[model samples]
Target: AADRVYLLAHGKVEKVGEGPYGAETVLEVLADGAYFGDQALVDGDATWSYTARAATACTVLVLTRQDVLNLAERAGSLRGHLDALASIPEQRTNKYGEAAIELSAGHVGEAVVPHTFVDYELSPREYELSVAQTVLKVHSRVADLY
Candidate 1:
């Protein structure tokens, strides 16, 4: 039930979840620069399926859901990046975050193999650079006084 995304800046973190038999299981061990609660970026109502605990003394950076939306509005690149990330289908990735391949093995008869393709982004994330300019004006009388 995390309302914000957490980025582990230093130390280690353990993602724990409950097993079917009411046992606590360690789902993943996250290291520095790892991201947790990232589903909040795409789904506003998303909740953490697992709990994160610090394995060691850790420094975490947190960003609320509204903070991401506000930043996305200001930066087109970030919006596009988030959109691309959200567009990835869950079925395409495995639990280890690797590409999943569908295969049929030891079939009695001929089986139809599932066809899958890797989705690639045609346009990668790009940033828009902004510049500011100012003009200083002075009167002739002011210059004479100086």
Candidate 2:
């Protein structure tokens, strides 16, 4: 079961989904700060519904559901914040079960202004043929395969 969610701290990961005909579906490639395995934590299901393969060398922070619950328990303010966030179904789906979340954020009875943006990055890393330096919490030698 995929009970632990991983926060991508460095590099990239490709989430592979199993199609109805046993084909592999290339789900979105996750970058740094991307969170995965939330469906199990949010929906209370622990079954592994997909597979994750490293697209490149990566570093991740694993957080179990229990870890989250413990954090929420330790902080009363966090519990309230979590409750408010969980109440909003941010991702929407139609009867056909396809992701239909509006690109412009807003929901019925709620007023949300659409956000526009310009190119923004914090010292963005450059990849030449998928090769770049990555940071690790522990100092060690990493494979230079990339």
| Number of the top TM-score candidate | 1
Which clashing pairs does model 2 show?
none
Following a full C-alpha superposition, what root-mean-square deviation does model 1 have from the true structure?
Answer: 23.2
**Candidate 1 regions off by >4 Å?**
92-109, 116-146
Can you write out model 2's per-residue Cα lDDT over 1-146, one digit (the tens) per residue?
76777989999999888665778887679988887987545545668756899999999999897788788899998778767757865555665346554444334554565554434567996656756677654212224433
lDDT of each: 0.84, 0.72
Tell how far residue 118 is off in model 1, in angstroms: 6.1
Best by lDDT: 1
**Once model 1 is optimally superposed onto the true structure by TM-score, how far is the C-alpha of residue 60 displaced, in angstroms?**
1.0
Return the number of clashes found in candidate 1: 0
Error of model 2, residue 52, in angstroms:
1.0
User: In candidate 1, where is summed lDDT lowest over 10 consecutive residues?
Assistant: 104-113
| C-alpha TM-scores of all predictions | 0.65, 0.56
